[model samples]
Target: MRIVKVMSVVLCSLGIAFAAMAKDMNVGFVYVSPIGDAGYSFAHDKGRLAVEEMDGVKTAYVESVKEGPDSERVILNMARKGYDIIFATSFGYMDPMLKVAKQFPNTVFMHCSGFKKAENMSNYFGRMYQARYLSGMVAGAMTKSKILGYVAAFPIPEVIRGINAFTLGAQAVNPEVSVRVVWTKTWYDPATEKEAAKSLLDAGADVIAQHQDSPGPQEAAQEKGVYSIGYNSDMSTFAPKSHLTAPVWNWAPYYKQIVNQVKEGTWKAESAWPGMDAGIVKLAPFGPMVPQDVQDTVTAKQTEIASGAFKVFSGPVKDQQGAVKIADGTVANDETLLGMTWFVEGVVGTTE
Candidate 1:
């Protein structure tokens, strides 16, 4: 009888230890593209790596997830597997993530570059347009043709806003500068992006800027001996000769903060759109070809932006039709920026 009681006590202790071990949080990540060495997915994967290093957290990720029903299946499977927090890191995953969040009320779903939200889901993105503006300053000063090319992924508001900000910044420096845009629709197609850049280069564009994930446009510029600005991450390594600065994302701090909030059971669904002031969006280092005066100008403007003394979308803004959009001395609010559907003056492309 005594031996049997001792065995029961040991078994109970083992069960308790197993329960404690299971308490570790399981975090899952869904990526829209392959996490290559650089670009949008790479930037977010860096954040995932950082969060995985924290104690008592186990991380899992599925890369190259399509943004449709396939993504919904993957997300649902992750939730079913007992993932505590899931991050769908793509704009197209918004609806799917929301649907999964509804079915799994206990799991937390965070969607990047999206607007929808549920009780267990939240949206987050940076004001990347601010950084795009800074990079445009470099493009405007370096371009001899006063004609810039933008290789874009989609015609969504995010891409539209970035293009507008880039045009505004270039015009701020060189009034005669005009921006030409080509939409590839796909976010991470290198061949298509390179072809689009070459087409722009053939059309007298001396400077190329891109919103696509790959360094294809930068590579094309280097081959043609032209300048280019990059997006998502620093792409100078891919085209050292023609590389200018890029708009970069720093998502590690935000990821760690969200993980901690979820761990503490204090996380709430909120729309987070942080910018330069929060270190969420920033400019990569300028290339050697950038003149000192231009660098100084961009730096001064960046400082003003960080201090909230300057607004990128401030008034006297106009559409392509020469009609005034925002009156003089006025500023566009978050609502106006989020719902942007028209091209600003100096843009040479259709938003359709």
Candidate 2:
């Protein structure tokens, strides 16, 4: 009887050890908006899904969490629940995520679109302006009135950089083109964004582009019989005939790479700002309305940007006031681009 009992105890201990060994790595994601929005959150969720498919990995998420105390609470909850890694996807979540990272030193935290980073936390964003420049080329080629409409989300550097890049691209193709901007100050308000698009249209803008989370601007352009550009994801379905091209985000590969690195005990904290060459950001396919010549031209430019043979912010760049922001025979670096707050020449909008 004693021998049997000893064997049972040993067997039970081994079983418990095996069960623990088989446990999957838990990953958590926090989003500012619902993944069903088919916009920004949706794009990140797609990356989460890719991570979910990995072997021995499990993922969960909280959606529609606000930026302030609410985001902090969600991140803390995930950390306390023993999530191996947490991803807070929003600019507003930056400070909150940094706070949580300091307490949960063992857990890894990744914040998107923010500048804060801790010993165990990292920030990452794509060079979306590169794709924006390409999309601008498309918009510039398609505009008939020489007036481009832009429905913007906020006056942040990210949005401002996109607007400026778009303006530069349009000006590259048609020096006579001008872009008008209207701010909605909200990320996902479809109705407000659509109205802003209409207002720009009313002001003689024949093409619309947006740095927003909804397809509202695209709908407005379609309703007004003009072309439109989209962001975050392929929005061609929403506007169909009026859709031109979009600067889209593809986070799957990057997310998968990070998860793999973490699992292998090789993950480190750093600012990751990859661009088209890394396959993080890309321009969506052109609509049927885009001419073949335009497509070829943009494709060549895309190749140039990806191959490091061209720099979008190369010299002679000017601000809205026509003051030289980038001198001739020079190029703007990542730091300048990150803190960009000025609109380029040919853009009719205030950064404020």
Candidate 3:
């Protein structure tokens, strides 16, 4: 009886040790908005959920984190709590995340929509502009007015890329169309976004589009009796009647890929440049307001691009001043697009 009791105690200790080793893959995420907001941060949180669903991985997140020093504080807190991998999901978290990566050499850190990397840190973002460009094509074909309104935040390259791609797509269908841009310089300011949309409407823009992370712009479109293109996530729920479609970035596949690598001991600091081809960037369902023909045309074009038979930026392209930016017969590559800071002809706004 004494021998059996000793054996049982030894078995219990061994079981506890095995469990501890098996639970080593704890991952953490930080977001700028509430997970339930149904917008930008919500999409990223969903990606984290998908990672959690993976066997042998534990995922956790801290939402509503601020941009600067406070963001660093949150990341450091996660590290202190024994998280093995940390994902900071905001452009503003770039510097802070890099700082923390230096401080925590053993922790693997990833920042979304940022361009800095270290041995312990890496950046990842999708070419959501591909989807945005397709939506713009639909907008051009659908809009009766040649004047399109763009509600945007800061004139950063990330935002500028979408505007340019959307403009290019719109021009593909309606050469006479003009995209009017208004900057809110904020990510989720409802009041600012609404007012920006109103200002664009007041300027005779009949179709609305936005790069901010609020449903306020869509709400403004609904009230003004115009159509809208949403961003980051599908916000048709906010303006079912006026919503057109959205360019959504599905991070789940990428999240799962990363977690699997960590589990298999092959996780490396690499950039994720997923597009329509890889199913990372996609157009949300067309709203009830979209015409069937418009949907067909958009989907066809998307398919062509995905299959590599079509090149959206293959150009005979010229800047606003008629200077050729991309020479005829040349396709603009990722590096060129990333450094782009010019507006094509007929786009009305300064890139400040």
Best by lDDT: 1
Clashing pairs in 2: none
Residue 21 CA displacement from its true place in model 2, Å: 8.0
- As for candidate 1, its clashing pairs are none
Residue 109 CA displacement from its true place in model 3, Å:
0.5
* TM-score, per-candidate, Cα-based: 0.93, 0.93, 0.92
lDDT of 1 at 235: 96
Relative to the true structure, candidate 1 reaches a TM of 0.93
1-352, model 1: which lDDT tens digit per residue? 9999777545543433343246998899999889993799999998999999999998999999999999999999999998888999989899989988888766778999999997678899999999999998889989999999999999999999999999999998999999999999999999999999999999999999999999999999999999999999999999999998999999888999988887765677899999999898999999999999999999999999999999999999999999999899999999899999899999999998
Residue pairs that clash (backbone atoms under 3 angstroms), model 3 = none
| Candidate 2, number of clashes | 0
Candidate 3 per-residue lDDT, tens place, 230-305, comes to 8878899999988899898789999888766655556667677778998888998998878888888899999998
- RMSD values for the candidates in order, in angstroms, are 8.1, 8.0, 8.3
Q: What is the Cα-based lDDT of residue 222 in candidate 2? A: 96
lDDT of each: 0.91, 0.90, 0.84
Q: Which stretches in model 2 have alpha-carbon errors above 4 Å? A: 1-22
Give one digit per residue, the lDDT tens place, for model 2 in 84-104: 889999999999999999887
- Backbone clash count for every predicted candidate, in the order shown: 0, 0, 0
Off by over 4 Å in 3: 1-24
